[model samples]
Target chain A: MAVYTDITESELGAFLRDYNIGELLSYKGIAEGTENSNFILHTTGGTFILTLYEKRVDRDDLPFFLGLMDHLAQRDVSCPLPVKRADGEIIGELAGRPAAIITFLEGMWPRRPTTAHCREVGVALAKLHLAGQDFPLQRRNDLSLPGWQRLWDGCRERCDEVEHGLEAEVSDDFAALEAGWPADLPSGVIHADLFPDNVFFLGERLSGLIDFYFACNDFYAYDVATCLNAWCFERDHSFNITKGAALLAGYQSLRPLDAAEVEALPLLCRGSALRFMLTRLYDWLHGPDGAMVQKRDPLEYVRKMRFHRQIISATEYGLQQS
Target chain B: MAVYTDITESELGAFLRDYNIGELLSYKGIAEGTENSNFILHTTGGTFILTLYEKRVDRDDLPFFLGLMDHLAQRDVSCPLPVKRADGEIIGELAGRPAAIITFLEGMWPRRPTTAHCREVGVALAKLHLAGQDFPLQRRNDLSLPGWQRLWDGCRERCDEVEHGLEAEVSDDFAALEAGWPADLPSGVIHADLFPDNVFFLGERLSGLIDFYFACNDFYAYDVATCLNAWCFERDHSFNITKGAALLAGYQSLRPLDAAEVEALPLLCRGSALRFMLTRLYDWLHGPDGAMVQKRDPLEYVRKMRFHRQIISATEYGLQQS
Candidate 1:
């Protein structure tokens, strides 16, 4: 629900002059991608996505995010490749914000994730990690352990407005994650936020993954752990072990995790849960109410974090010992 | 910005099974059309618009609206044809709401309409009227004078909050319109709401008119007058004679207005302006403060109605008496 910037026809015609895509036939603000304003563009050439990177996205990270898509598309990973201009520039300016056009990927993100969808996403996740290994640009995961604590500090005083004992429970979880956080085992570009909404599915097959704004250099297992927190949860906050097992099996089919990486899944999952909870908590406490932006409940992640705190092994999450 | 009805994958799949359209490739909630929830659905066959009629639309009016589109499309009016199911039904239930899929029209509604676009819409409006002559359905324009008076009574008390002495000014305007309103002058189907957003264009050529929720039986000249209010006003609320003339000239080229119709243009335009103002005034005083639906400034139409009041002849609006 975002079309913050308005582009006039003459200005848009001038902008499209840089690309080979033919004259604009039609374009509308699409209700997709919360961080940036997205418009589904249909031109004489073909359909493409016009993204105006909003304030939430770092202007400096434009190169890395767009470049990663360009790099990964050259490989076998199915994702939206940034459409380059005549001079080979991928990024351009529109409505005074850093804007770019990417080829429209043809698939819908599943609204309700089945066990099969979880497994397919895991396989695609592993595939993205493998394809991203040789990518040149590197961005450190900012929503890691330290990032979680930093986000928590902003919301600590009023976190209980959302829940009675949420503040203390989250603080203790952060302390445990900081002490036991994994420093090694495997590292590469991971889609740190590979939720189902970011993964497109056409029928039973995986079509592509999107929203590379959160892609960064991070532990591969941590990425998998984020998937556990995101994909394996039921509507009532209970963890679905079948979904967990299927997702892990699908990932392991492509790239087998080492013993250390396997053991760190529980802690990594807990840390990932805390990372999301802290940011959501920040938005929950501060987001402008009644605006078009849908505010997610931070307490959903709180329950998941508590579930991870009790996990003794990856086997509990439907993983077989490697 | 409307997708009030949330459709799941399985539910969507089951719904699509009822139609002959092939497998669903992608479906995205489009931020277009205020009355209904619209999603641009892509399937193996081709792209189409899937609209779920919201509470704003009357359930019984579905047959008339859908039948009008069906009838007009058959008559070469260039409107979206409702896709019928194998059972030959245009309407179906999805997400517990009445839904239907219409053929996707290719073109963008001009954000800043030029005189050329104005002319194109004028020609198209006349063509729609002439084409709709033999259509069986007859829907009274409820949003006409009677509707305006009913709406104004509801908001008359609070209308002053929007403007100083607005109640008196509007009351006087209403009294004048009721006294001078034309009883007959080329009656036919009129698109009661012909705002720029409902009119699509390719370059300066009018691609098609859309959002037929307000389509009903009314004076043809009144519809032309609504266009004058909608398309001929500048952002500053000043009337652009070039636009008004172009639009009226375009309409007359296809179906010439009678001398009486020509004489009634100024009064009809004023009445049209008041109609919109009353509705917008009601919403302005009543719209939820933080709701996503944008409440239009009622003063815009007040200013437009005043401008129309000063006009002496149809020639002043670029119309020549035939």
Candidate 2:
């Protein structure tokens, strides 16, 4: 567990003096993350999660993550609500790290989530898109096309050393993508990393959503493509058509995608897969040398990139003609 | 560009004093990583890439990365050979960062790598495993099983907040995987990141391999599984049996996998996918703010995870019974 900061029970109680969340009964470090230290705090009022930002996270971005949760909660997005301190500040300092307290959401992360669960998540994600429509914040997807090229440049030398011709091929693909990137689309806040582990459920229904760290302004349908790439695969990495249909149908039910958005699904999915492949490749090339955080295999995303590359036709993504 | 140390051309030239390489012609910053600053150095001797270790990479690991490259080169592995100083020193200090000079490989990364390309990569990877059979190094796959759980613990809270129920599912999967992990398997040096970007090609023939950063000791077949996950997927992130067959055949032609290895392929593939999914998920939850690095959609790996989950039958992975 990445414990950027450690806090004792008494220390946490002193920190919670400003919040209205009653007395802190107990707190323990929740071992998880590559960036921050997390503590599950049980108080007289209720349970809450206290996060202490580590080196990986920028101090300035705390408001965006915390504020988004607060905003989403106010809009009934079924997520953790950030608790502001008595000084009306949501962000605070704890254990020598930037910290914030959020209401502990009740429910469990589903282990055997079904296709129906995926569909529900799809619908919920669409709802989140809708709910975040008028959010006052304006953060762009900084890690989009340009960011990809930057990463490619960083690992280009070593890239060819591992796999033959990977650098040139990816460069060519990236050039093509850059040459013809989509311009106009229905854009809004996108939950960039809506993986199954980031969601909580009560049975087949989605109880809540968590982790708004990657939420940024981007094409809404791209989020759907991400979901399809995530929730519609069988055990052999084969596309599960039934699950795909359910997920798509569920998304369309809430926020009907524009024709342009639908048409761009395949390309977006490809771009999305490439985005991951590049990041994973970069990390694989230069992840931390430590016993704490393990380096990820970049090949998984490489497979995803190949799959997205195959999705040449719009129909392949089950989208109708624009 | 993440230049941990900003040195002038003269400073860099002075730093390259004892190297076998000739005078530096030019150096340009490659703005492309979260861990290190890379400069493509043009010298009278040849074009080389100079990497300056940044925050994410430990300075101590410089020896490992450099030594591994030297070892592979000595064993006839087509890799980027680390350049040593005239004083027989491989490590150096540049701009207050641990730095090294390495030969720049020539080739393109396959954008639309075919089944043939997959086969060649498989063969080369197998050969790499064979070459490393007696290497003096013994780096364990720290990212294998326990590392995943550690990451899960760090990101569990924000994980649910991001995707909903994904945390529990991942945890359960991790637990199940831990309970039945393969106790015994042939272990050796594996190029864990066998992605297309990591493989270099000079036309139809395989030229070289890059990115040995994730290379470590593990089941040799796990490397094959990593290749399959990377190279056997169609554009829609779906499995392609033809590609899979070619890749496997190529691997067998060089170093055939045993019965136990074949039987373990499916689980290893699943485990490989899960490893990536978890890491990507962690990055999604706690990506650095304003950094050039892109956070890959964790959902893509979620689909991959699902696919691996469905591979309950050994026959599904083209394994034959002994």
Candidate 3:
């Protein structure tokens, strides 16, 4: 209930004293987030975001998250660069949580992002995946297919209580997904949560990307699946063919997906949709009582899962013939 | 963190003692939900679901939720029936939370729900609207056109942090929706969340409906919008015209839509999709961070919203000329 991490002006000043960055002039908590507690710090030299790892974030993964920023920044990717300490460590302990300070990149996350936005995002995402090809550290997508089933298994008995036979149907769908899991596609580090909010833009151009929490080594096409599910639709929750076309073209223009990747897109999109649906469904079924978190209607994703379920045929997603 | 409410064997026995209808043989906590704590109770008479209101549920609204069930049941609509307690009250206190017991209908929520299922759901939904014509409660959809802008305003500042210019576009859409808001359409209570998980089926027939938390008085065609968003889509999140046809035909068979309703279908669908996208977008901006509640990719709905945005003409939704 108490403030999990409270860094006063003096405390933050002392915290940054050991860092190579110039004198810290001002710092305050950014109240607009639900995940990590972020403080926008304005120093004599520059501006940066100081994030204190929250409950949802694994402390052990702080290095990976911070190191990823450093790595991506070094690769000329327009992303936040982790400000290292004098000891050369990118992460630090503050307010009893793993913390890091990173130079804030310019540009805003697109609000009314247009089809052109989707296209640029697709291109940028492909480039990010390529840039991550040689990144040192590796983490598996723990919330992938198998992980989803395990979570569902935990909530199976309760499923019937919420809606009669919801458990059985979910089980069947999971089984089907498992049985048809794609094999031997191009694999690499992917920004698995490439939602529009995570991607920043200046004018019509994509400026940078953020939120690497779900970034992991996975099938390259799955990232495209994530994008198609994210960017191709408008505010009304309907599919836009023009946007879909532009996005796919942009992605292909950058990375040029092979025949297998193109073939796997529809299924991958379905899997991506199901992945979120199952997770959201699980959360809907078992979120802790009286928590500050607002629970989303799992039925929304249920509709999405159903939409994806119908995409069994390759032509359903309008994938260009390889 | 410890179990918030523990309904032990003796406690549940005492709780069920006053109910007049059936013999309580067995009761168990149903763990598959994120909203309310549910128990599947098998009595000498029949099976029922005992739902304990959780945090997200407003205790005051228990009457609306429970009464709607009773109202629907009285109208010969297939839905759960709320059981009255010995005190002549439908609502009761359990585990320091508002609670109620309702008859559990037979059938599954449909995992791989087919196009046939979509048609059946459309028909059932139409029947539900017709049956709900004279229901006493006068609740309006809290998430209607204006409600969306209100939510958008609350989260607009942080909107830049997620999707760029979503705030402005949503505002513009709201203006457009308001300028052409439909009036003089047939009015009725609509099951606003008609997703596959909320509809139950026995073999090929729809046996019952659940989750009327979003039911409200609105233009009848809005229900169709909800359905088109829920059904008539393949798993890959693309619209399926064949499925759409079946669903429309089925609904028309139950209660034929008026010309105005048909004319408004595309915008209504767009409105419905935007409603969900905004809700999901708000959640993405300000939802709780936990291992359980996975943030839905807002971009999925974003893509859906965009599709709806492109539908400037009624012909886009395939409405036949009256």
Candidate 4:
């Protein structure tokens, strides 16, 4: 529901002159993607996606994100590649916002994730991590431990407006994660937000992944923990052990986790859950009234955080020990 | 921005089992169409639009609207044809709402319409009217004069909150329109609401007209009046006579308006303006706060209503006399 910047025909026609894609046939504002405005573009040459980077996306980080997609696609990862303009620049300006066009991927993100979907996503996630190993650009994961602290600072006093004991619970979780946070692991570019909505599929097969705005350099196992929390949870907030086992097995088939990475899984899961909860809490409390952007309930992640806090070992997540 | 009903994968798959369309490759909720929830579905066979009728559209009117589209497309009107299910029924139930699939039309509605676009829509509207002549379905226009009074009744008290003297101005308009409303004129199935958003175009050629929820039996000249108000007004709310002339000229080239129809254009335009104003006012005053449905400004129609009040003859709208 994000068409914040309206592009007129003449403006679009002017913008398309820089690209090799032929004359515009038709274009529509897509109702997906929350962080930025997206449109499905049809041209005489081919179909593509036109994305206008909104205020939330940092303009300086555009090169890193676009370059990662370009690099990964070259390595045979199924993802949308940014289209280069006639001037060899991938980014352009339209309707007073930074905009770019990318090749459109054909698949729908699974609304309801099955065990098969979880396993395929785990395999795809491993492939993405391996493919991104040698990428030149380096972006710090800003939503990691320190970034979580900054986000928490903004909402500490008023956090109880959402849930009664949310503030103290979050504070305890932060103290535990900060003390036990792993300093070193196999770090690479991780799809930091590989939620089901970001991963596309056709039937049981994985088609591609999208919404790379959150990709950053981080611990690879942290990415796996994020997926364990995101994909294995049922609607009732209970973790499905079968889906968790499948996801871990699928990932281990490609690149098995070391002892240290496996040992850090529970804390990583709790930290990942907290990161999402903090952001959702911030948006829930501070989002403008009557905004078109749908606000997600932070309490869902709160439940996940509590579930992760009780886990004693990776085996509890149905991860088998070697 | 209207995806009021969310359809799950299993539900959508079950719904498609009743149709002959092949396996569903993907589907996305379209941000277009205000009256119903629309999804652009891609399948192994072809791409199509799936519309779930919302509460705003009467359930009984489904046959007339779907039949009219089927009727018009068969007559070479170039609109979307309703796809029939395996049981030979056009409508089915999905997500507890009446739903149907229609062949997808290709084209974009112009954001900034030019005079050439205006002329083409006039020609298309006239073609639509002629094509719908022999259609068996008969639906009275609910947004016509009587419907305007009913809608106005809900907003008359709070009308002043929108504008200082809106209530009195609208009351005087009702009194005048009731006394002088035409009893007998050329009548047939007319698209009561032929706004620019409902008409799609490829370059300067009109691709098609859509959103037939408002299609009903009414004066054909009144549809022409609706188009004049919709397409011939500049951003400043002033009438663009050149565009108006082009539209009337394009329409007359196909089906010339009779003498009585031509003479009644000014009042028809005013009545058309008031009809839209009343509906917009009702939605403006009563629409749920924080709802995704964007409420249109009722004052725009008020301006158009005032502009049409000063129009004395069809000649002012560039209608040439034979």
Candidate 5:
């Protein structure tokens, strides 16, 4: 649904002259990414994805996003590699927007993620974290605590419109999280939004991870928390512990969690839930009328927030003590 | 922008089992056709397009549309051929909708079509018409005179919401067109919606035609009239006679227009314009609020209708007098 900028044949022909990829056979505007225009470019060489960064993405963060993919792919983390131009720059300009072409990954993201899918996602995410440790670039996770607070403030007055008691419940949750939020967890580059839609799999085996736009340097445990919120919840907003156990066990097999990290897991889950809920709430209140981007209901995250609040230990999430 | 039906990985895997196509490698929802939900399916065998017919298209007409493409491809017309299932059935049920797979056609549609592109389209369209002459199944062109009148009746009251005096102008247009409507012309299967978006080009060569959903039994000259409305005008709504001449000459090279057909060209063009304008106006007035499908301005077609109304001869459309 994200074909905001239309690329003409002559313009695309001129643009491809800068790259060594073979003659352009065809290109299609794909309904893949949300915040940018994406086209599936076919050439005599191979198929690739062309993304034009829209205004929602910060221009300065292009290097960090594209470079992270480069670093991860180099480390054998299955992900797209940003194709460099003859000038050696990964980013180029097309249709008045910053653009880049990346190698097309071959897999479909599971629509209904199973327990096996959760386990594979956990392994892929940990591998990404380990691979990203040695990367030179850094980008602050802007959707962190302060950012959540700003988003909450923007939508607090109108949040009740989405759900009658949403505003007060979120306000109280914020106060609780602020008082007990973890200050010292292991930090690294994290795919801050590791939703099922962003992870691809060929059958049961995880093929690759995508949508690195939300990726940034943050507590790796926070990234894990986001995955827990995304993958372990059923349609009824009920936590599926078997899926949770599978996800956590798969991650711990790669990078074992410390005692301190285990204790902080429940609170981090609440924080992650808050981050998504606040953003969704802000969009629910302030998004332009009739936007093509379907609005994710903030109340879904609200239910997740409420579930996490009742949790007393990581054990409740089916995390086994090592 | 038309991914209305969400197909699960499991659903797709089960669906592909009925076909001879190899293992499913990947599938992505594509933004190609406006009405039906389309997904580009990549399998071990090859790439293909999976289309789920939405409510906008009638289910009964599915055979005619699929059969036409199959027939055209058999006769060497460059278009996507519908892939049949094991039971020799071309259509099947998926996600509560009728679905079919077709071989993916390679090439991009011209965004800013030139005179060369227009000529190529003319040649390819004529080739399609010739190939489809032997097509067995016949589906009536629902969006012809009666269809236009029905659409006009539905939107006439609120048509002024789009323009101040559109109702009166359109009424006069209807009176004139109905009186002069051709009772007979070179009749055959016609691609009623052969817009530039439906035609693909690889460089200057016309690669293929697509979106057979609007194909039906009609006057061949009426199809040409749709193309003239589609390709021979600049963005400013001014007719480009050079492009028009190239298109007509290219088409005539294959299927020469008879005297009666040539004489009815201007009226056919006017009818074509009114057909599109009425549909656009109806959609504009009655479309569900916040629809993802972009509503095209009826005013553009209104201008075209006005242009065709003044033309006294087919020469104005660049048709050569033999």
Candidate 6:
């Protein structure tokens, strides 16, 4: 649940004057994104999402996030395009927070994703990577190895509160991930946080991708690795190889992976798992003690990373050998 | 922040099958109402609000809530009429909670209301009261005097945590409220909680009323009293007489206040003020320590109640003596 900032009618009316979109009919604070205050804006023109970027998101990266969406939507990729203001600015300010209005996309994210949904996500993600090739803005993956280490250090003393031996086990996992991190593998603009919640579908067909707040320049295969962790896991923490095969097969249908990219898949998967685990653990220990936001169980990611640790080859994740 | 219940795609799809509303296009969990999970459901037909009643709301009282909206809408009052299922049932079970789909009302609630907005609210609220006159179903205002004392008892020991001498002050206020509480003065179906957030407006016109979860049989003047505390106060705690005058005058345009009701206005305002102050104080002291929902500041209402205590007559609140 979100909407930390409240936008007033007069302020919103003043803000809308800079846009070509018709009169503001209504807008609602949405319980969607965590790092931003999101409102579903309705106007005589049509519906759009008005996002007021919160403090957690860096203001400097606004152009990259908005520009990437605009770039992707222009191509065959299905994504929201940032509505440009009268002065041709994609970003604006509202209630002391940087904001942007993005064209609304019609779809609901698959909550209990089937194999078909996984395949559709693979196809959409690949299309996004292809479309983002010429996006003209750059943002490094902030949740990469170095960032993970910083997060781990911040909560290292209290990390064991989650699991009895979580601290020591994660320390070893950190060392391995750092040593075997992918140096190079088909790098492009990757939706670094391409979780199922960010991918929306109209039934079984992919409609759009959203929450580009975490989109950045990284290994495209690393994006695939994130999805492998997010989409392939069953409720019992068991990996579903059939879904994995469907995802990879769908990805290959659009953009084929090279030899080295496939080989680095398992390590990238470990890195992705570790990345989410460390952040969740840090939040579990240090997040605000209140009833306004629900905390995700860090131990769930601990179970996931543990599962990824046992895998030796990309073939275990249903990727075909070249 | 709201939307506590998570509805799976298959579950929602199955639920929507019972309605002729058309294919589900998109739905986003809204962080609006506190007691229920509200999802903005967009289908091929149009936009609607899907509310899954949380435990805080009584399931048995749902017919009254749903039926009141249906009845009020038929009488030309703007509200979210409950969309019935194929079997003409307004209520259904979804995600283990009692849920219903209501037609979406367009407009935004005024954050910083002006005198014009207050006048518009007065006009619409009277209309709702008039339309609800024949509403057959009856539900008591459980949060009235008795409920206030029960809440006060739960937090009496820790009442001083909010302010020194608070316990004694509130005890006296309670005694006075009980004695002065209106015995009978033109009571009808009242939107027991018609705070600015529950009322919507497009431009200056009051588009509709929402969050009827608190609607019940109570003094119509008491409902006005709730608004007096909710709408007429400035941020610094001083009452705005201009806004109050507009609200009173606009409301009297349709439903003239009886002499008895007018005489009882001050005590009813105090009662309204105390009712909110008690619940908010209880939440402030005993609300969940971890993340899930927000607890409003109780001291603000305490200040408003104090203001009402000093007032001699309704004339002080911009109401002309009848």
After superposition, candidate 2 runs with Cα above 4 Å error: A1-322, B1-5, B31-34, B318-322
Best by TM-score: 5
Once fitted onto the true fold, the runs of candidate 4 whose alpha carbons sit more than 4 angstroms away are A288-290, B288-290
* Poorest 10 consecutive residues by lDDT, candidate 3 chain B: B1-10
lDDT digits (tens) for residues B169-272 of candidate 4: 99999998999889988899998888888888887888888888889999999999999999999998899999999999889989999999988999999999
Higher-ranked by lDDT: 4 or 6 = 4
Tens digit of per-residue lDDT, candidate 3, span B159-241: 76777877787677777788877966888888888887678765567889987777788888888888888776666877776
TM-score of each: 0.97, 0.50, 0.49, 0.98, 0.99, 0.97
Candidate 2 TM-score to native: 0.50
Residue-by-residue lDDT tens digits, candidate 1, B12-118: 88898889999998999988866788999889988899998889889899898999999888988888999999799999999989999999998878889999999
- The CAPRI category of model 1 is medium
TM-score of decoy 3: 0.49
Ranking by lDDT: 5, 4, 6, 1, 2, 3
Runs with alpha carbons beyond 4 Å of true place in candidate 6: A288-291, B288-290
**Candidate lDDT (C-alpha), each:** 0.88, 0.75, 0.73, 0.90, 0.90, 0.89
**Which candidate model has the greater lDDT, 1 or 3?**
1
The predicted structure with the larger TM-score, 1 or 2, is 1
Q: What are the iRMS values of all candidates?
A: 1.2, 24.9, 25.8, 1.4, 1.0, 1.5
lDDT of 5 at B252: 90
Instruction: Looking at model 3 chain A, report the run of 10 residues with the lowest lDDT sum.
Output: A1-10
**Residue range B75-107, candidate 2, lDDT tens digits:** 888888999899899888887777888887655
Residue A227 lDDT, candidate 5, scale 0-100: 96
Point out the higher-scoring one by lDDT: 1 or 4.
4
Provide fnat values for all models in the order shown: 0.79, 0.00, 0.00, 0.55, 0.86, 0.90
TM-score chain B for all models. 0.97, 0.93, 0.89, 0.98, 0.98, 0.98
